[model samples]
Target: MIRIELDEAALGATRIAMSPLRDAFCAAHLQLPGRAPSWPYQEWAGHARAVWREDDRLRPLWELFTEGPPGVSDFLMPRPLGTPDVYEELDQLRATDPAFVRAQVAVCYPGMGEEPFLRPYLTDPQAACAALADAYAAWWEEAIAPCWPVMRRLVEDEVLLRARTFATEGVDALFGGLESRARWERPVLELTKYIDAEYAAGERRLVLVPLVFAEGCRLYSTDDPEVLAVSFQARGAAALRERTPGPADGGDRLGLLLGRGRAAVLRELAGPLTTAGLADRLGLAPSTVSEHLSLLAGAGVVTRHRVGRSVYYQLTDTGRSLLALLAGEGVLGTAAA
Candidate 1:
């Protein structure tokens, strides 16, 4: 098992509320507007997935799965499956949990009027948002309030690092090979556009850019009765190697997964297609593509949609953020900072 040492020094370095990349991300995000323009169908699953991953609330679920239990499933997977998310499971697990909910809640820097991204939402600005807008941004904050800090501590490190690095690197060639190799396709401007759309719709969804990767982690399939039961746990970088590297470690072979075929898959559909379509185009099996989609979706890069019989995919708000990061928009901080 790996231990998390809460060093004040490390926290001090990471705790900056408004880092350099945040600014560049905003500017770069201004690029995407009216993407496909309210088409016959809404292929915005990418935006949805991206929003979920980037939010501050997810931190709790992550930390719990990592540091709190013998089997990570105690924090994530359900027993035979009641509900998919673990918000309910926590009530039972809270009593003896070493990394309780309270600590997880701390890492989240509240964005309501605190950060520039949220400043527009704090008041009656030029755009009058709808009630749905008001409901979204504040929901998860309340849900995981008990364990915000734990998640906060672990999240956004790699995300912020990549963001800053993108700023310094050439914007066009920012994310190394994430785009060309991973078929990562998002313009930073698109993210702001989505947020603006939500705000205009009166929906108050909070948008964050924290990148979540299942790399260095295992994938749970529908065939698996129990995910954590069979899966192994990796503690930080060390323990992860002992079992199987987490998706964050690139266990998913994310680079190879992102390729020209993925790009064509999206373009050929005229919108978005199911995982099977993507797989066929990539010259890989459907399951292989699904795995890639999961990683991409988790990283706030791809989008997902459930059609009548199948689920389709696309890029999201966070995907746009990464595009900007890759474009050298916000990579201004020191390498390690």
Candidate 2:
């Protein structure tokens, strides 16, 4: 168990962010031997396995992330900054101090830095950082980028939900509901892990990140006194592989009543999604989705909010209740409800 002691200052400084690089790393970690991805990711894992086998350059990263006899190196876990850009996080990884890298490698690998597979990281940490960054970029492009859109939306929706929980409730409620593996006990947040450790989060920022690929909770902390990050699996991960119900699909009462296009739109709005995203998922024109969204919004079933430049629509309480009632009536699928 790892107990993180958070003072009032630490609690105040706590924030939630998403990290694409961390998602990539967690996905890679799941591909290691003896580790199987969840059922929803079987297809994706097959493709990622092919990429890992074909790319020799990714071997170091693979070993570093997955082949950890002790554990993954903390330095490789980039600090979460709430940015969706993977390149920005990769830049941070590329800029890590050589001495810091060596020190972390020593702690994680323990006297194996000079080994043939790990020599590059210890001998010339700078070059190693650049190489690892390049490797990760390639890995992301080849394996994770194609699926990042849905993944990103899932994580973004999670952050929004968590933010709301933190706002309406308090820190205790927010952390209490984070995950089952983590227990929030007032000033102390206990995380179940492979080793026993403790961290005094005096004034350092506490970053909470959600990953679509993370199977369980992961803690990223060091002696640096900068930030303590905890990453856990995000909700709606199964949606990645779930096929959206079309209007033509039989036994869709919601579709029959709302029209297939509108029903599909409402179903996807379980989490906030943009018109373009809804269109892409439902194979409808953006204008058509906009029409449906406009009607739904006017009917008080869905509400729209603007985040930066994009507008997202989500289901209201009435919408959720309607879905639930329909689900109970055997009209809508459980996923839709």
Write the residue-wise lDDT of candidate 1 on 1-337 in tens digits: 1111222332222221211122111111221232231221122223333443465544433232222322222212222222223333333333323232222222222322344332332342222122212222233333323323222322322233334444455333322322211221222111211112211211111122221122222222111222211111111111111122222423323223454334333232222446654543344577767776676777666677674566666555555454345433342322221
lDDT of 2 at 288: 100
| True-structure lDDT of candidate 1 | 0.31
Provide TM-scores for the models.
Answer: 0.20, 0.85
Query: How well does candidate 2 score on lDDT at residue 108?
Result: 79
- lDDT per residue for candidate 2 within 223-281, as digits (tens), equals 45587788887876665554644546477777777887788788776566788767656
lDDT of each: 0.31, 0.78
- Identify the leading candidate in terms of TM-score: 2
Cα RMSDs of all predictions? 21.2, 4.0
Worst 10 residues of 1 by lDDT: 232-241
